[model samples]
Target: MSPRSGLQREVLSLYRRALRMVRTKPPSTRAKFLLFVRYSFHRNATTISPRQVSVIEHLMRQGRKQIEMYEDPSVKDCWVSKEMKEWNERT
Candidate 1:
């Protein structure tokens, strides 16, 4: 197989970081958190146009910020609940 592109590497790194952060969550909520992450990435999979480099970079930055925010212990307390709630509302 061929090597991954830079954008692909960045996307994978962000996904890995997000999953790593999920470990910090409570066990009871870990599965839900993982589902949320998977759903989020999958939802955007088709929305990222190959020609839009700027849009891809912007999404990467947003993903990084999301991971950072979730990593903060103070925010971690309500992160899953709030996110799941929002996800529920959206659906």
Candidate 2:
């Protein structure tokens, strides 16, 4: 496979930053935050074609904004359900 493009690298960097940000949350709620990040990023990945550069860029901008919002200390816990947990594990 060819090397990843700049936009692909940026998307991956954003995802890595989000995963790293999960460590800042309280230990008790860390799992919830983790599941949230995983779900949010993976949700639309299959639906969005790689050729859709405009859509990908727009979604990346949105993802960056969301990561910034959740990176704040105020975001201690995220609401996650049993089904969501199951899905997270399955994926």
Candidate 3:
């Protein structure tokens, strides 16, 4: 197994973070959200060009923003999920 490149690490990190956030969503919607996240990543995996660094960076920024918004308590509900919010409050 070869060492992973920086870009590969970034993509994996984003995917993991997105999934973690998805866990905070209501149970009924979690599956749909997971499917959408997986589909979006797979759809772009083939078309991404190594030469286009700006495009990759832009997508990363967008993904980060989307995650931030999704995790924000004010955006989705009056409070973040109890389990996760308690974890956040501790650290």
Please report the candidate that would top lDDT against the real structure. Answer: 2
Instruction: Put down candidate 2 lDDT per residue, 24-61, tens digits, no spaces.
Output: 99999988888988887777687899899999999998
Per-residue lDDT of model 3, residues 8-31, tens digit only: 799899999988987888776675
Candidate 1 stretches with Cα past 4 Å from truth are: 77-91
- Candidates ranked by lDDT, best first? 2, 1, 3
For model 3, name the residue pairs that clash: none
The true-versus-predicted C-alpha distance at residue 72 of model 2, in Å, is 0.8
lDDT of 1 at 49: 83
- What would the C-alpha RMSD of candidate 3 be, to one decimal place? 10.7
Query: At residue 33, what lDDT does model 2 achieve?
Result: 88
Worst 10 residues of 3 by lDDT: 76-85
> What is the TM-score of candidate 3?
0.74
Could you tell me the C-alpha RMSD of candidate 1 in Å? Answer: 3.9
Per-candidate Cα lDDT values, in order, are 0.78, 0.88, 0.73
Each prediction's total of clashing residue pairs, residues at least 3 apart in sequence or on different chains, is 0, 0, 0
